[model samples]
Target: MMATAVVLDPAVTMRTPEWLFLSTGIRAVDHAVEDICSVTGNVFSEGASMQALRLLSRGLLGAKARPEDPAPRLDCLTGAWMSMVGSQSGVEKGASHGIGHALGGTAGMPHGYTSCVMLPVVLRYNQPVNAAQQAMVSEALGQPGTPAADLVAGLVAELGLPGRLRDCGVKREQLDMIAEAAMHDRWIPTNPRPLDLAGVRALLEEAW
Candidate 1:
């Protein structure tokens, strides 16, 4: 989910709030329950991904409030679609996803759950190199003043999602293996910041 939002072209301007309102209409229909409840499945330029993030944030918050509302549901779906626009256009997933792939494969965690646990930690770790981009992420999530990592953590909490590596049965000892495996992931090269085994270890430790 974070990968989806992080990969868009930041140059594109989108009135995400407007889209949310237009899609939901005035029916008070509960699309949130209809959409967010479903499980599903990127990366690319920061510009497009930022717009997608804004859409996703609004959609998610709205859906959380009115799970049964169609407007927010539509917004969530569209936001999801937009999130992957970067990957489709030639962008790759970054460290958050690369590490997630490692966690899911080695730790036997679910793909969706991996993001819930790793994204916040990875975002914080990468902020030194991508503070501007991370700020856009915070804004898109509708918490411009908040740290992006904190906002992501809050979102996971609100969704009743797991927020810790330990919650998924990942052991402290497994951190080394996960980091090594993540170093080999294809997406690692695309991470906003250059990554090494030591960096990966630190990220895993934080997530754990």
Candidate 2:
């Protein structure tokens, strides 16, 4: 059942540890990136996705630079909410979200951490097909001309979050299983860049 209304309060989120907050904030960043780059995306979702990136990047970095302040988390919340708007509009996410699910299911990784590692890898893999769209993502993240993948990795690094599969303790042997599982995810087919099983495996290897 869908809720008729939703409410968000940044005050209630302060109790969460800083590291965890930063990790999930990256997941919100991943959402915006995926929404803007999805094969079926439109201008309405692109607008919201760009705004989400703007707010998340500023707010997440602000929190990293000033952990003593609680104000930036409100920006994060608003940005995350904007991401939900794009998602709810049926703008499908791509291989990043798909591979992230495989990591969660096959290796017990959190969606946030998986996003940190996989979003960059997936963006790089898709870049050849979607460079123009990705340029917009990098610009929204405050770094035009930088690869969107590098910008995301840099943002994750600034937050002191883990940025690799090794950092999350996933073993190399698991890459094959994760890749196989990722192929079955609904979002994989919707990726802006077409991905067969080999492409999925290549992405996992890069992340690993």
Candidate 3:
């Protein structure tokens, strides 16, 4: 059962380390983006997800520039919360999340860092299946007409986060194992773009 109440105290997290804070912010972005792109998402969830992205982008950049400030921390927390609105309503994520879970189990990659490296790649991989939904993601990130994958990749670069599997120290050989494990993730079957083991391995190769 879920808790009766939850409180958000951004002040308590105001001092979160920059690396953890930013990568997790990307994780929040991943949540919002995937929900917006999910095949089952509705107008309501997409709306919340869109707003979450806007808030996260501002808050992340704001906190990066001024870690001593509390206001941006509030924005980040609120954005993260807003990002999860879909989870409660039954919107499922896609390959980005599925693959991320495997990368975590196999390479011990931080959850947030996995999003940093995989989100953009997965976005590109799924773009063909959901180009219209993906465009909405770009608009939410305040980058109209820019491919969502490129915009997200740019954001990762802006945060000084690694965007490739190799940069995260998953040796070239590990991609195959990660793919094998990712095939079983609950999120895998729901990915907007259908995927097989070969497809999953291809994505890992491209991300590498």
Candidate 4:
């Protein structure tokens, strides 16, 4: 009921289709539409980000009940966070989230689970672009002493998330399409680096 209510809220209603479709087989243009619907329709920004962060903080640090699980809130909040992260870093479509979408769709893993697991890898991959940003991410995760990239990996392990795409039931052959689709995602603009289809494909292969 809580998730249903949350999804039906004006902020989230607009982005629902996009989240539903960016799967192992969905086309890139469709993914773009999803992103557009999400940002323009819901128009989540700084305010939404703050609310989400508050909810997330309470969920992660203050409570363990179903209401505070963080998973449902994450679907909306994390995307908003990434959009903000994209804005702040001047990088669009940043990191392993695209990869996580593919793996999550193919494996029945939730989006938050995918994000939690794959972000560390992307954070590491993008480290050369901004050590400071990565460090901030490390600190946010409460792993201040760990290397930014490795901190993500360590956090994923500690969180009991999937460590590899293969572990999530992704096939060897599907990596190409996943990478290709990810490259076309509008979020691509937020990435720290300009990832081509080939580059995304390579990352998929490596993750595979």
Q: What TM-score goes with each of the models?
A: 0.73, 0.96, 0.97, 0.57
Off by over 4 Å in 4: 1-93, 104-109
- Tens digit of per-residue lDDT, candidate 4, span 92-148: 345555666666555566665556545555665666766654454445435566775
Instruction: Report residue 3 deviation for candidate 1 (angstroms).
Output: 19
Off by over 4 Å in 2: none
* Model 3 residue 99 lDDT score: 97
Ranking by lDDT: 3, 2, 1, 4
How accurate locally, in lDDT, is each candidate? 0.61, 0.89, 0.93, 0.47
lDDT of each residue in 33-58, candidate 1, tens digit only: 11111111022345555565666666
Residue 84 accuracy (lDDT) in model 3: 90
Top-lDDT structure, candidate number:
3
The deviation in Å at residue 32 for candidate 1 is: 20
Give the root-mean-square deviation of each candidate in angstroms.
10.7, 1.2, 1.0, 9.0
Query: Which of candidates 1 and 4 reaches a greater lDDT?
Result: 1
Inter-residue clash pairs, candidate 4: 91-190, 91-191, 92-189, 92-190, 92-191, 93-187, 93-188, 93-190, 93-191, 94-191
Candidate 3 has what TM-score?
Answer: 0.97
lDDT of 1: 0.61
On residues 1-208, what C-alpha lDDT tens digit does candidate 3 reach at each position? 3557868787788667889999999999999999999989988899999999999999999888888888888888999989998988899999999999999999998999999999999999999899999999999989899999999999999988999888888999998899999999999999999999999999999999
Please report, as a residue range, the 10-residue window in candidate 4 with the lowest summed lDDT. 24-33
Which portions of model 3 show Cα errors greater than 4 Å? none
Give the Å error, residue 31, model 1.
22
